[model samples]
Target: MAGAEDAGERADRFLAARFDGVSRSRIKGLIEGGAVTVDGATLSDPSLRVKAGQTFAIVVPEPEPAEPEAQDIRLAVVYEDEEVIVVDKPAGMVVHPAPGNPDRTLVNALLAHCGASLRGIGGVRRPGIVHRIDKDTSGLLVAAKSEPALTGLQRQFADHSARRSYLAVVWGVPNPLAGEIEGDIGRHPVDRQRMAIVARGGRPALTRYRTIRRVGSRASLLECRLATGRTHQIRVHLAARGHPLVGDPVYGRTRGARNAGADAAARAALAGFSRQALHAATLGFSHPITGKWLEFESPLPEDMGTLLARLELI
Candidate 1:
């Protein structure tokens, strides 16, 4: 950044001003975590002063591999072109890298399929990914091939211009046939693994939904559209509305409905759902290169299909 700063300025402030995406708190954390150094000595105080000609270094982690090793995992290719590819990713497919799962993600498969075709997307590990869905959510996803396509698709997502829809089977029928749920989402105060609809400090998230069918007294089929995508937004929003999905162990019912006095039949039906009953059913956007409107829809996965058949729409 600044080769050297005046002696009175705080290190955090100096670093924040120089980095485009860094915040003051983040800089402070980095400084306190020994990631920053002054004159080759690790400085743990954010408010420490930097004298003229004092060298500063921030040890940034090396970038992860852009393309992970490809496995022979089968992928359902829904659509593809020179500029982009739409994939019907099955449930249980990790989208990207994380702690325990560092590979075998959809990105790895795409890298193998697309090969050198995927050049610039965040390097070899992540190629062409404009956005992501959770591992358990089976659905269609679009990935970019070229930088222009990546930039254009990202803009659509940022502006909420891309149309994305989902289907879910929730624990209880929402009283209204259709509605919107809006709130700010943030990490749970107590549990790091979960998100919450908190007020004080969180990102705004919105979800809209309409009832597709009422299933008995306990559940409803729904079509949901995301106005603002957030981690676990649909599950959190629906659960907040007191209609958690039927099999959503994380956000919905737990310990089997039999313990809740449901009959064996209902409990079996509920047992059929092991993951959140959610799927990205539809996705639509304008092609980045061709400028033509494109839309793709995915039917309910086998388990959900069977459950819905039992529910009997007729």
Candidate 2:
């Protein structure tokens, strides 16, 4: 960022623009935790204003192993049997290992918790994994523990027979109060890191949503059910409808946010929510081996519950 116009810009914004495809959140993480320097001086504040002549640098750490190591991380096991395990995963936990995160994931926790029973899947480190929710979306997830369980569960998801439901606090009430949002979801054409509605070469996705509660017209609590699982499906669909989830870092920006934040306390509550105000409230599926139906429900985590109370949408 070298021009006079770039001088007062936030460091994370400027760096994100220059980094090409890297997210603002990623840049913020680098500035705050992953070492970042400006003009040969260590600078950790993501909001620091940059001088026109300042040169910025960051140390990008090498990606870790493909095989996740077993970690004794605590897990909220909702149900478990020899064939499968269901977990009430908290927010801030990645489901599986990926580029930025290598360990301490749900997979690592499962390995340590299940021991040798959770063997690798087809020589891949991700074993028994059938489906996933976003990293920051608190929810219930099921992992298969044996070969038959994995195959059967995968078949259910593929056939769109597995059931999932999410509760979201959105910026504004949807127009119809209840409806189906259908779109083809794929990677955003420009921002590769985010998913978006695309007309071509994208997979079909369907979300059925109903307004559960309303805070005047400023916001609403919505129950969203998935008919097809796609990356960021609910987020992209609701955002396209102009009612993005509260606190969703991606696909949640809109001019309507100003109206939602009209009140001082509302603004503070909205701003303070660091993760998407979304929770996987329920999940249902058939037991792979027993051919028995199983389902689980999770109440809103404390943070989301408190947010609703503050916003008066409870």
Candidate 3:
């Protein structure tokens, strides 16, 4: 079965639901790149409706290994051993090398810290990486030293067995105290650089959040968790719910506080917040080799603390 679906179902969604391990974006990329064929005819439109009993073929590109080089960069190592290394990643640090950012990445620093102990996981570029956080998001990150450790960590993340928590200052209060945001996230139909909440042709993403403190009408502090990991999951979910971050230029910008008739001290403090207020606060998982549970936490970055202090929420 080519994963038969309703006659009016979108082509991209049909293929993604039928094929295990393929992301909705990957499927859409295939369709847009003319790699999807319906009954041997190349299909270019991802939203094209499929008829019942139609067979479609989606060709996925084989990713070539990235040849990343190590640079002499300083890394704040929190913990290290034969199997794993934990580090406090500062804001503005790219987790790994990619196009436009060829050097000065966490991978380069890890290469320097671990030397040849970094085991290649399927590629030279993604050495020792089981998962990753967004650039500009500060927090604790774990890197693997051995192949077995890498495999174990990957399994934990894939099964959602790892305990991961994040802290963020959003634009408004998230109602219901504690609740879940279950939506399908997919690439925006117009903007390729952004993700959107969609009804069809997207993958299911789940984010659980609890309100920690309300930071006036401008924002609120939140502790968030991920039941399913997708690109920009937390940011997208919050923005969709009408509560963008204070300094998140990508999703929505915070209005200037001049309308609120704030005092000089408040204005000066608000100007200091320039980056998206998000941080990975805690991570826990089973030890790859020792079978012992390991957990780590990162202190709030200076920018976050400064924002809270200025707002008198600390």
Candidate 4:
């Protein structure tokens, strides 16, 4: 059963194309979980080449009920209305519940704040989560309180119409003051936990950045704007350009160690910095229900601000 058109296609890719609204990652997970079969034989290898005319079957189990409890956590509520709520999320806070992080997330706090209004927006686990920032990155995020708001926000993000801008302190200044970084981002072939720039079989990603200020020729503050919302888009793009973010544990170790010329204060500041010096400074999108254009901004947190001051002083 070899069809010329379908031969040599990766199993996961082939299945993902056939299944609407299911992600390739999800397809791989299903395959690894023994929920996918080829010609009545269980196939667990997501990368196996697909032969044309073969019968592929997938078993999708019902999602487990999400039973997260609400906690009284304080939030930096920037704006709130009947439709949506915007918060200036601090660094180190996970947006939703995961295996390791089951509680004390933004979702828990929102559950307490929004009460029953958040129900049925983003399903049980990620109710109202339209978009997300990394746990170590801080910045503005908006969550829907109503179904219309959630649908509207999701549409804008899907269409790449939402404007998201971030500020980061990176190891070196870019050659040009402003430019665009374009690449195909996908999972690392070897390290499943990390992402990488791939030659093919990846989604397109674009990041526009400009140098905000140079910190004594050792570091620079850059404003990065996202054209495509991929996981770790800004971090991966800047790291690929050899300007990894300051204090980024995942991508900055080698580059950060090269900052040798800074003075004692600057070195101390750089070493003391804990998380990546990245913040979602600005977010703008149209109101899903009212069709009104709304925007929000957040200033640098105290930790990043103090570090920048020390860099300037040195």
lDDT of each: 0.80, 0.85, 0.79, 0.85
The list of candidate 2 runs beyond 4 A from truth reads: 1-63, 123-126
Runs in model 4 lying further than 4 Å from the true structure: 1-65, 122-126, 255-266
TM-scores of all predicted structures: 0.76, 0.79, 0.74, 0.77
Model 4 / residue 180 / CA error / Å: 0.2
> What TM value does model 1 have?
0.76
Candidate 1, number of clashes: 6
Kindly report which residue stretches of model 3 are placed more than 4 angstroms away from their true locations once superposed: 1-66, 123-126, 254-267
**Cα RMSDs, all models:** 8.9, 7.0, 8.7, 7.6
Off by over 4 Å in 1: 1-67, 122-126, 253-261, 311-314
Ranking by TM-score: 2, 4, 1, 3
What TM-score does structure 4 among the candidates reach?
A: 0.77
The numbered model that scores best in TM-score is 2
Candidate 3 per-residue lDDT, tens place, 36-153, comes to 8999998877888888878888777666345666677888888888889988888888998764455688987887777777665665534588778888788988888877889899
Higher-scoring candidate on lDDT, 1 or 2: 2
Q: State the weakest 10-residue window (summed lDDT) of model 3.
A: 253-262
State the displacement of the C-alpha of residue 143, model 2, in Å, after optimal TM-score superposition. 0.7
Between candidates 1 and 3, the lDDT winner: 1
**Candidate with more favorable, higher TM-score: 2 or 4:** 2
